[model samples]
Each structure stands twice: as structure tokens, then as C-alpha cells.
Target chain A: MDEGRRPDDEKGEAEETAELLREYERQIMALPVQEHVERMLTTLSGLALQRLGIGEKEPAACSPQEARLAIDAFRALTEVLAQDEPERGGVYRATLAQMQLAFVSVAGGRAAGKGGAGATPETNGEDDGEAGKNGEGL
Target chain B: MDEGRRPDDEKGEAEETAELLREYERQIMALPVQEHVERMLTTLSGLALQRLGIGEKEPAACSPQEARLAIDAFRALTEVLAQDEPERGGVYRATLAQMQLAFVSVAGGRAAGKGGAGATPETNGEDDGEAGKNGEGL
Candidate 1:
């Protein structure tokens, strides 16, 4: 977090990240580490979808409550992963920061008497088209 | 990708990954990075939500095309991230891997003429309860 400090040496950073990963692996031994992260990711993704009302056939199906949960789960885990390893956690930090912003945007938008993600159907529709055309499309 | 050989020095792998991340970042930069990833994440999640169909006013709103798009984008990015940096990219690899599986599940289920994520409503409901107790029930 130092403003003027140089980034961690990539070599040292990688080694430290590897060590932390091993420790995390041991910490999550009760469940397959992959499976645990997947579930949390899926939960967050699913709830975000609902908040956007994309999975629904009706007008709006946003559930801000559920979306918050998914976001929390992601943040909670990533924060743990980030502990004592800012260099290694940079990607997750960026990833979660964007997510946090997007979630807050939606929440804030709704609070301003606008609407949830559903408020921008036209924009979302365009994204769907553009996103659909890019590679495997899946 | 070496099967018999041991992993590279953390230095070697980290350098390679840095190179790859730069490549992927460049590729993504043409696109509004945040919007693009959010769309992909939400698309996949929305598909998952449709499969679950919680809080729905009607039947499934599953879109195979959009779901495929989401899965494709996630895989494409993560695959790039995972190259040569398994140690540092482990979290992203795990994150996207599960998303790919969940997206595939939804897609495969659709192809097989089965239900969507809606098939997993029971489990999702419980998550809802647990999520509600967390702060910021947004």
C-alpha cells in the first residue's frame, strides 16, 4: 500500500504466493479447495444474476438481499486469501473491487429511486448481443 | 503443462505468467474491462439463476446463447491467466473452473431436455437464509 514503494519482486512474490497457497490448501482440507471456491463463486454469480433480473421471465426479479450475500461471500474469502500477501492477492483485489463497485452501483442506483440492474434493459440487451458474438459464445 | 517434469522455479513461472497476464489484459482493454467481465459473470450467474428460478414470477428465462457466451468469456480469460502461473493464478483458475462447470451444467441440462438451475432450488433456499443473516442484507 506504499504510495512510492516499488512492486514486490516477481520472483519473491511468486514464492510467497506459492507458500501461502499451500497453507490455504491445508486450512481448507475438509473440503476440496476447488469445490469450496466454486460454490462461493457460483453463489455470488447466481445472486448477481437475479439482482440483474436476467434469469427471469417477468419484468424485474432483483433481490438485493441475495446479491449482497454472494458479494459478502466472495469478499470474505478473498480478504482471507489476501491477508499478509498483498502482492499475490492483487488480482483478487482487483477482481473483488470491481465486483464491489458494481454491486454498490446497483444498490445505489436502486436507492436513488431509479431501479436495479433491471433498470437498464436496453443496455443489457446490447451487452447480450455483443457478448454473445465473442468467441465460443458460451 | 509439463507432466513428468517438476514445476518451474517460482521465478520462471511468475515471469511467464506476468507475460501472459499482460497479453490478456491487452486483449481485454479494447473492451471496457469492468463491463465486459461483469456481463460475462452475470450472464453465467443469470443462467444459473434461471436454472434455480427463485423469486421468479414465471417459468425459466434461461438463454442458452447468453449462457454459452458467459462460459466462453470466463474460460477464455482464465485460460490465459492460468498459463505458466499455476501457483499465483490458482485462485482465478479455481474461480473460473467452477463457473465453467456450473455454466456447462446449465447448458448441458438444457441440451438434455432436463431442468435448469431451478433443479437445485432446495439448496439455494438455504443459502438465502444464511445470506440474510450476514450484514448489509442489501
Candidate 2:
């Protein structure tokens, strides 16, 4: 008998990738216009958090959960775009600009907070607790 | 005396254009990430509607309001990227992709609905009336 490749090998990966892409596109397509924007905002918030190095152990400036959602949305959007048009270079420029603004906002906000006496960088874990509490509402 | 020299003749058009660009940049910077994306989405939706000959008589298959917010977020993101490195050209690419997707979703959704017997085109006037009436809650 002639040796042949496994039946599932060729189709599995391609199918999986296609399914994933389709799912992502559907999610984006399903989003209400407002929700889509909200998703972008969430992504920006996450980028801001990353830039500020603010986490569970740090002074909570913004909600990490919201930020995470934003990042997920952004990723989904990007994946959908890539699947649709890989060759289009300017397609993502707008999204990038939005992300950059988010980063700057977080950076600037932190800088401003530091400038004031009320928002001092915490030395101990005490402020982390407060941050956690505040982050909960975020 | 030189009567030929007008009172406001110092490259007024160029100055105005520059000022407008700066204003656009500033607005983008101030917007939250999500808002930028929404704005872009709205613009895309409008473009799609125009392409489909769906004029203002019908509500877009997608939410124009939501898309507008996303666009704003994207615009802000782009402004920030352009500030850092105008030559990179990545930010522009991303924005274009997003716009394309938004347009495609609206146009495709309309076309797809038209092609399918089960799918019904929602009239612009009936959008609010049918908001929660159907299982579709987006």
C-alpha cells in the first residue's frame, strides 16, 4: 500500500484557522455600533495600564478588567482586518492612532497625578489595597 | 500707499488649513480610545450606505452612532501615531482597514439580507420600534 498523509492533517489546521477568523469577524459584525466603540475604548485603557505598569499590586489608576476587554476587542478587530485585507497597509493606521492616544493619556494622567501632592507614588503595599478597591468600580 | 495689500492677506487659506489640521489632531488626542473607533465606524457605515444607494431613508444595517464613536477613537489613535513618526505609515494602514471592514459589514449585511428570505431589512424609522422586539439584541 502507498504511504499517505493522515486524513485529518491537511484539513484540521486550515479549518481551525478559518473558523477562528470567521468567529472573530462575526463577533465584530455582531457588535452594536456603540459597543464597538466601547470595545476600542477598553483596548486603549489596557494599553494605558500597560504603559503605566499599574496592576493588582500597584496604585490602581484604571480598571484592568475594562482595559483587558478593550485589548480583546482590538485584537479581534485587527484579526478580522488581517483576514479581510492583508495587503492593505493603511487599513490599520487609524486604529494605531487611537491606541497611541490611549497610551499618551495614561502617561500624561500619571505624570499629572505625580505632579500633585495628593497622588504620590506608593512606597508600600497600603496604596495597592486602595487601588484595588477603586479598580473594582472601574 | 499700497491699497493692494488686503487686511487679512497673510496666507489666510494655508493658515486656516494648518489650524484645521491641528484642531483635528487635538480633538483626536482628547477623545477616549473607544470613541475614536465609534467615529470611524459611523463614517464607514455612511460610506457603505452611500455605496448601496440606501440613502438616509433607512437605518444602516449596523449602528451608525456606534460606528462614529469607533471612528473617533481610531482618529485619535492615528493622530498620536502620526505625531511620533509620520513616515512609519502603519497607523494609516490600520485606519483604512477598519473603515473597509465597517463599510463591508453594513453593505454586506444589507446585500445578504436581501438575498435571504428570512432576513428582513430594518427601516430607518422602525429601528427603535424593533429594538427589543426581536431576539437580536445587538
The residue ranges of model 1 lying beyond 4 angstroms of the native Cα positions read A1-31, A54-59, A84-88, A114-138, B1-138
Q: Tell me the tens digit of each residue's lDDT in model 1 across B10-116.
A: 55878998999898854543333233334434444444344333234544333433333334434443443343235645765665566556545544444334433
Tens digits of per-residue lDDT for model 2 on B30-91?
44444544454454444433333344443445443333333434444454434334763375
How big is the positional error of residue A40 in model 2, measured in Å on the Cα after superposition?
Answer: 2.3
Cα deviation at A64, candidate 2, in Å, is 17
Instruction: Go through the candidates in order and give each one's C-alpha lDDT.
Output: 0.45, 0.45
Model 1 over residues A1-138: C-alpha lDDT tens digits?
554654566557779989998987545432322233445455455555555444456424454543444454455445434442467458666766666666556554554343333344334333232221221211
Q: At residue A63, give the lDDT of candidate 2.
A: 35
Count residue pairs with overlapping backbones in model 2.
54
DockQ (CA atoms), all models: 0.03, 0.09
Residue-level lDDT of model 2, residues A1-138, one tens digit each, is: 223876577577679979998998755655554454445445454554543445424434353333433443454455444432465324454554555455445533544454432343342133222232233222
For each candidate, give its TM-score against the true structure.
0.28, 0.34
